[model samples]
Structures are given as structure tokens and as C-alpha cells.
Target: MEMAWFVIVTVMLAMYVVLDGFDFGVGMVYPFVAHTEADRQTVRASIGPVWNANEVWLIAAGGVLFFAYPKAYAAGFSGFYLALILVLWLLIFRGLALELREQVDHVLWRQAWDTAFTTSSVLLAVVFGTALGNLIRGVPLNRDGYFFVPLWTDFQPGAAPGILDWFTMLLGLSCTVILAFHGANYLVMKTEGLLYQRTVSAARILGWMSAGYTVLTVIAVPLVQPSLALNFSRNPVVYLAPLIGVIALGYSLYFRIRGRDTSAFLASSVFIFLMLVSVMFGMYPNILVSTTDQALSLTVYNAATDSYGLTAGISWFVGGFLLILTYQIYLYSQFWGKTRADDAH
Candidate 1:
């Protein structure tokens, strides 16, 4: 039951990453993709209908964690309190920028919000990637299976390391680049005219950049957290996730060059999904690893809630998720084609 919930949580988070990542990527490159007011409006229209719904997955995943592993949820939330608050503000600003940019007629007003949208999205991607790095690289958990981390310390990866060590920063930058690539792919699929041309051209370069950084990060991972090496060593089959990620990445670029936006976009999404799958595989069973002490790692069994709670949680989750999935399908179907600046929200 615990393992099942872990899988559920992982899938939910992965969904958030893949679904929202392109939006973040799109926002990051908003200025570059748009030359006119209509171009910017069209870019906004492409994501306007779906961005909010995409974020619901993150909230759902957090709720599941709270129910399934209350202790870990508490510790993680408290330990990363400032970071979480920053993420919240980013989400808020991004949403407001999208809504208010259209509501105001003044050029300066819309531009201000546009800047907010792009800046917030880029920072959010970096923060999320860094957070994942911290999770994979482990924290300084003590004997009681709890730890607190400041923004940084000595810029190291060991027990008193800050949140922005060289390794975590690498992970953050990797995520940012790929998300920009992902966003470019999305724009190519959803827009027309000069915006499409620019996005397509940028996507190719960004795709290669994402792939290169991913390779560098893969090599750096073992050096930053050697324990992740133990997981790969134990389960040879787990390597398939990363392998698929590389293949999807290459396929995405090929499809993009061939002018198949839909295929390229799908491939980009798959690459992000598989990348997370590989990370989860490498850190299996351990929700939060310990850098301070090996014995303090938070494993599935150690951190799970009582059996009764998880069993009840699973039953409720299944029923609620089916409804959510149905609505999402209907919503996407309603807005399936290319978006124009004049399209209604």
C-alpha cells in the first residue's frame, strides 16, 4: 500500500513537471518568440486555457504526500519553508500576469505583467529543478529522520551544505534549459507566422542544449551523491528510463527539423517524463535521503502513515482521479487546434 501511494505521488509529480514545464519554457522565451503585440497575445492565448488546470496536479501530489507520509511532509515543508513560499509567489505572479495583461489596455501595464510572467516562470523552473537535486542528492537528516537546510552553506554537498551547491545549481540549470526547449516545441505546435518560425528555430538549438546538459548532469550525479550509484548497480533494468529519455530527446529534434510539430512536442514531453522516471528509479524506496548520516534516510517503510490511512486514501484517490481525468480530456478536446490572438478564452 505504501509503495503504491509512492508510485501515485511520483506519477502526480511527473505529470506536473511534463504538463507545466512547457508553459514555463514558453514563458521563459516569451520575448524572443514575439515581435508584435499580437504575437505576444497569441502566445498567451495558447496557454491561457490550460495552465491553471495543469498546476492542480502539483497540489494533488502534495495532498497525497501529506496523507501518506505526514512526517516527511512536515519535515520537508518546514525545512524548505522559504523556498516553498517563493514558489507560491511565483505561481501567483505568473497567474496574475496572464490574467491582468489582457485586462489592462495600457502598453506599460501589459509589459510589466509580461516581464513578470517570463521572470517568474524561469525562476520557478530553476527552483523546482534545484529542489529535485536536493532531494536526490539528499539532505542532512539526523538520527530522528529530520533535517533543516538553509539557502546555502560552504557551497558543498555534504552534511552542512547549502541548497545552492554547484551540483544543485547544475540540476537547476539543466531543468531550465530543457523546459525552454519544451516550451519552444509547444509554441511551434500551437502558433503560426513569425512566432512559429522563431520557436522552431530556437527549439532545435535548445533541444541540443538540453541533451548536452543532461549528459553532463548524469556524469556529475554520482560524484555529488554516490549512493544513487548503488541503486543503478543493483538494478540494471532501471537504466531503460534514462535510455528512453535520450532516445526521445533525439527523436524530438529530428521531428522538429522535419517540421512535425506535434511529434516533436510529444517527444519533448516524453523526454521530460522519462528523465524524472530515471531520477525516481535511481532514488527508489528513499523519499528523502540523508547527507548527514546514512542511517537517517527516509525510506518508504519508515515514513509511511498507518496502514489504515493509506488504504482509505487510495480508495478516495481512485474515484476522484477518474473524474479529474475525464474533465481534462474534455477540456483539451475543446481546444485542440492552433490558437490565434483573437481566440476567446
Candidate 2:
């Protein structure tokens, strides 16, 4: 039962990443993709209908963590307090920007909100990515089950590293570039004219950045987590994720050259999915690993709720999934097709 809930939580988080990650990517590249007022509107319209709904999965995942795995929820949330607050602020500002941008008629008012939206989205991606890096790279979890991370330590991957270490920072930057590429691809698919061309250029730039940085990060991972080397060495098929990612990168280049926006955007999504899965696979079982102490590693089995709780959670999760699935299908179906000038929320 615990294992089942573990799988459910992982699947939920993965679903959220694949779904909301693209929309967040769109917002991250908003300023670059849409230079003019009309262009901004088109970019906004492209993701307007889906953005809020995209967030529901995150909420559901969090709810599951809080209820099913309360220990992890408390430890992770408290340990990463600063990051959680920053993420919340970003989400709040992004939400306001989405709602208020259209409500105001003044150019300055709309532009201010648009800037906030884009900036928040960009920062959110970086923060989220760094959080993942911190998890994979492991934190300084003590016997008390709580840890703190300052901005930085020595730029190495060894014991008791800081939050903004070179590795984490690079992870954040990699996330930002990848999402920016993802967003640009989305814009290329959803909007046309000057905005499309601009987004295409932006996608090309971000694509290269993401590819290069992701490669560097992948190479650095085994160094960061010596235990993960076995997953690659013992099970060669695990390498397929990165292989698919490279293929996706190639598709991004090809689609950009051929002006195939939808294909490019879809390929970018695949890239994010493969990368995320690779990371999760690398850190299997261990939800939190302490770099300073091998004995302090927190595996999913150790962090899970009791047997009765897991059984109850699974039942509830099934009902919730059906409800969420129904609404999501309706939402996407309603918003399908290329966004138009006349489309308004």
C-alpha cells in the first residue's frame, strides 16, 4: 500500500510537471516572444485558458503529500521554507498578471502586470529546478530530520553543501533555459506573424542553451551522487531517457528550421518529460539523501504513511483522479486550436 501511494505521488508530480511546465515555459519567454502589444495579447491568449487549470495538479500533488506522507511534507516544506515562499509569491503574482492584464485598459497597467507575470514565471522555474537539484544532490539532513541551506558553500558537490552552490545555481539556470525554450516553442505553435518569428529565434537560442546545460548537468550528476552511477552502469537501458532527449533536441532544431511550431513544442515537452524521469529514476527510493551522512538517507518507504493511511489515501486518490480528469478534458477541449485575436477569457 505504501509503495502504491509512493507510485501515485510520483505519477502525480510527473503529470503536473509535464502539464504546467509548458505553460510556465510560455510565461518565462513572454517578453522575448511578444515584443509588441498585439504580440503580447496573442501570447497571453495562447496560454490563458490552460494556465490556471494546469496548476490544479500541483495542488493535488501537494495535498496528497500533506495527507499521505505528512512527515515528508512537513520536513520538505520546513526545510525549503524560503523556496516555498518564493514559489508562492511567484504563483500569486503570475495569477494576478493573468487576471489583471486584460482588465485594465491603460498600456502601463497591462505592461506592468505582463512584466510581473513573465518575471515570476522565469524565477519560479529556476527555483523549482534548484529544489530538484538540492534533492538529487541531497541536503544536510541531520538526525533531527530538519536541515537548512544558506545561499552558497564551496562550489563543490561534497558534504553539507549550501543552497545556492554552483551546482544548484547551474541547475536553476538549466531549468530557466529549458522552460524558456519550451515557452518559445509554444508561442511558435500558438501565435503567428512577427511574434512567431521572434519566438522561433528565441526558441533556437534557448534550445541550444538547454541542450548544452542539460548535458553538463547530466555529466555532473554521477559526480554529485556517486551512488547513482550504478543505475547507469548496471542498467544500460536507463540511458535511453537522455538519448530521447537528444532526439527531442534535434526535433526542436528541425522544427525551428522548418517552421513547424506544434511539432517543436511537443518535442520540447518530451525533452522535459525525459529529463524529469531521468532525474527521478536516478534518485529512486530515496526522497531525501544527506550528503554529509550516508546513514541519514530518507527513502520513500521510510517516509510513507502507515498501512491504514495508505489504503485510505489510495481510495481517495482514485475518486479525485476521476474528477480532475473529467474537468481537465473539458477544459482542454474547450481551449483547443490556434489562439486567435478574437479569443477572450
Candidate 3:
């Protein structure tokens, strides 16, 4: 049951990344792809109907984590309290920038909101990537299964590492580039005219950058945390996840170059999905690693609630998950196809 919940939570978070990731990507590339007000509106319109709905996966994942793995959730939230607060503020700012940008017709107002949107999006991507890095690098979990990390400390991932180490920063930058590429593909698929042309050019450049960063990050991962290699050595099948993810990224770039926008977007989605799956595979059972002591790591068994609670939660989760899944499918179907600048308002 704990293992089941682990997979469930992983899937939910993966869904969030694959869906809302492009929204972040769009925001990251908004300024570059959009030249005039109409271009900006077109870019916004591509994601407008579904961005908020997409975030529901994050909220649902959090709720599931709280109930299914209370210990891990508590430790993660409490330990990363300051970082979480910053993420919350960035989310709020991103949403407000999206919703309020059109409230007034003033050019300065729109530009200000645009800047806010892009800045918040980029930071959120970096923060999320850094969080993933911390998870992989392990934290300073004590015997009590809780530990705190400052924003920075010696810029290293040693025994008492900070959140923003050199390794984490590298991953953060990689995430930004990857998401920018993803967003560019999405724009190419969803818009036409000069916006499409600009996105195509952007995607081409970002694709190469994403690939380079991905390779750099992959190389650094084993160096930072040798256990990842040990885990792969134990379960060789897990290697397929990242292997296929690389292939997917290659296909994304190929399709983009070939002018197949939809295929390119889908390929990028697969790449993101598979890359996350690879991480989960590498860290199976262990929800949170302990730098202080391996025994203190939060595994599925140690961090989960009692059997009764987990069993009860599954019933509710199934129903809610289905409803959300249906809503997302219907929502996307309704908003499917090309968007125009005129559709922004």
C-alpha cells in the first residue's frame, strides 16, 4: 500500500510537471517570442484557458502527500518553510500578472506585469529544479527525521549543505533552458504568423542548449551522489527511463526542425515525463534521503501513515483523480488547436 501511494504521488507530480511545465516555459519565453501587444496576447491566449486548471495537479499532489506520507510531507514542508514561502509568493505573482495584465489598457501596466510574469516564471523553474537537486543530493535529516537548510552555505553539497549549492544551481539553469524549449514548442504548435516563426527559432536554439545542460547535469549527478549509480547498478531496467527520455528529446528537436509542431511538443512532454520517472526509479522507496545517516532516510514504509489511513485515502483518491482527469481532458479538448492574438481578450 505504501509503495502504491508512492507511485501514485510520483505520477501526480509528473503530471503536474508535464502539464504546467509548458505554462512556465511559455512565461519564460514570453518576452522573446512576443514583439507587439498582439503577439503577447497570442502567447498568453495559448495557455490562458488551462494554466490555472493545470496547477490543480500540484495542489492535489500536495494533499495526497499530506495524507499518504504525512511524515515526509511534514518534514519537507517544515524544513523547507522559507523556500516554500518564496515559491508560494512566486506562484501568486505569476497568477496575478496573468490575470491583471489586461485589467487596464495602459502599455506601461502591461509591460510591468509582463516583466513580473517572466521573472516569476524563471525563478519558479529554478527553484523547482534546485528542489529536485536537493532531493537527489539528500538533506541533513537528523534522527528526528527533520532538518533545516539555509538558502546558501559555502555553495557546496557537503554534510550540512545549503539549498543553493553549485550543483543545485546547475540543475536550476538546466531546468530553465529545458522549459524554455518546451514552451517554444508549445507556442509553435498553438500560434501562427510571426509568433510561430520566432518560437521556431527559439526552440531550435533552446533545444541544443537543453541537450547540453541535460548532459552536464547527468554527469554531475553521479559525481554529487554516487548512490544514484549504485541504485542503477542494482536495477538495470531503470536505465531505460533516461535512455528513452534522451531519445524523446532528440525526436522533439528533429520534429521541430521538420516543422511538425504537434509531434515536437508531444516529444518534449515525453522527455520531461520520462526524465522524472527516471528520478523516481533511482530513488524508489526513499522519499527523502538523509545526509546525516542513511538509516534516517524517509522511505515509503517509514514515512507513510498507518495501513488503515492509507487504505481509506485510496478510495477518495481514486474518485477525485478520475474527476480531475476527466476535467483536464475535456478542458484541453475544448481549447485545442491554434490560438490567435484576437482571442486573448
Candidate 4:
């Protein structure tokens, strides 16, 4: 039951990344891809209908985590309190920027909100990426199962690690680039005219950047923290995660070069999905590792609720999941196809 709930929670988190990730990518690269008001509107239009919906997955993931693993949720939330607050602020501002930007007529007003939107988006991406890095690298969980992390300690990995560090920052940067590429690919599929060509160019450039950064990060992970390599080394088949990622990346690039929008976007999504799943695999049996001691590791078994709670939660979750899934399908179907001026309003 614990394993089942863990898998369900992990899947929910992955769904959040795959769904909100592209929209976050769009915001991160919006300023770069959009030169004029019209360009900005089109970029906004492309994600407008589904951006809010994409965000719900994150909330759902968090809620499920709280329900399924209350202890783990308490530890993680309290330990990363400062970081979580920053993410909250960024999300709020990003949403406000989207809604308030067009509410005013003044050019300065629009520019201010646009700048706010892009800034919040980039920061959100970096912060979220760094959070993932910390998870992979492990946290300084004390015997009490909770510990606070500063923004930086020694600016290095494996030390009394902080919220930001060289290795973690690299992950953040890689995440930024990867999402930018994803967003650009999405734009290619949903846009037309000169903007389409610009997005294609952006996608192509960002794709190569993402590939390079991904390779570098993968190489550095083991060097920084050897524990992440334990599972893969013990079982060679685990290598398929990275292998599939590389193949997906190649397909993304190939399709992009061939001017295949939908395929390229799908490939990009697959690449991200594989990479995240690899992380999940690497850190298996251990949801949150204690940098201070291996004995303190939070695994699916240790961090979960009692079987009775889990059983009840799982049944309720299944019903809610199906309803949400049905709504999502209907929503996407209603908004399917290229976004244009009509979606901007």
C-alpha cells in the first residue's frame, strides 16, 4: 500500500512537471521570443487557456503528498519553508502579471507587468530546479526528521549544503534551458507567421543547449554524491532511463530539424519525463535522504501513513483522479489546435 501510494504521488508530481513545465518554460523564454506586443499576446494566448489548469497538478501533488505521507510532508515543508515561500511568491506574481498586464492601456504598465511575468517565471524555474537538485543530493535531515537549510553555506556540494550551491545551481540552469526548449517547441506547434519561425529558431538553439547541460549534469551527479549511483551500478538495466532520454532528445532534435512541430514537442516531453523518472529511480526506497546520516533516510516504507489510512486514501484518490482526468481531456479538447489572436483575449 505504501509503495502504491508512493507511485501514485510520484506520478502526480511528474504530471505536474510535464504539464506545468512547458507553461513555465513559455514564461521563462517569453521575453526573448516576444519582441512586440503582438508577439507577446500570441505567446500568452498559446498557454492562456491551459496555464491555470496545468498549475492544478502541482496543488494536487502537494495535497496528495500531505495526505499519503503526512510525516514526510511535514518534514519537507518545514525544512524547506523559506524556499517554498519564494516559490509561492513567484507563482502569485506570475499569475498576477498575466491577468494584470492587459488590464491597463499604458505601454509602461504593460511592460512592467511583462517584465514581472518573465522575471517571476525564470526565478520559479530556477528555484524549482534547485529544489529538485537538493532532493537528489539529499537534505540535512536531523534525527527529528526535519532541518532547515539556508540559501548557501559553502557554495559547494556535500558540505553542510544549502538551498543553492554550484551543483544545485547547475541543475537549476539546466532546468531553465530544458524548459525553454520545451516551451519553444510548444510555440512552434501552436503559432504561425514570422513568430513561428522565430520560435523554431529558439527551439533549435535551446534544444542543443539543453542537451549539453543535461549531459554535464548527469556526469556531475555521481561525482558530487555517490549515493545516487548505487542503484544503477547494482543493476545495469537502470541505465535505460538515461538511454531513453538520449534517444528522445535525438528524436526531438531530428523532428525539429525536419520541421515536425507535434513530434518535436512530444519528444521533448518524453525527454523530460525520462529524466525525471530516472531521478525517481535513482532515489528509490528513499524519498528524502539525510545528508547527515544514512539511517535517517525517508523511504516509501518509512514515510508513509498506516495501511488503513493509505487504503482509504487510495480508493478516494482513484475516484477523484478519474474525474480530474476526464475534465482535463475535455478541457484540452476544447482548446485544441493553434492559438491565435482569438485566444489572446
lDDT of 1: 0.90
Native-to-model Cα distance after best TM-score fit, residue 75 in candidate 1, in Å: 0.8
3 or 4, greater by lDDT: 3
| Candidate 1: stretches off by over 4 Å | none
Clashes (backbone N, CA, C under 3 Å), per candidate, total 2, 0, 0, 0
- The sequence of per-residue lDDT tens digits that candidate 1 reaches over residues 212-256 is 998999899989877788898899888888898889999998999
RMSD to the true structure for each prediction, in A, is 1.0, 1.8, 1.0, 1.2
Clashing pairs in 4: none
Local accuracy of candidate 3 as per-residue lDDT tens digits, 247-267: 999999999999999999999
Q: Report model 2's TM-score to 2 decimal places.
A: 0.94
Off-target runs (Cα >4 Å) in candidate 3 are none
Q: Indicate the worst ten consecutive residues by lDDT in candidate 2.
A: 1-10
Ranked candidates (TM-score, high to low):
3, 1, 4, 2
Please give the TM-score that candidate 1 achieves against the real structure.
Answer: 0.98
Residue 114, candidate 4: Cα error in Å is 0.5
Q: Tell me each candidate's TM-score.
A: 0.98, 0.94, 0.98, 0.97
Candidate ranking (lDDT, best to worst): 3, 1, 4, 2
**lDDT of candidate 2 at residue 255, scale 0 to 100:** 84
Pairs in clash, predicted candidate 1: 152-162, 153-162
Clashing pairs in model 2? none
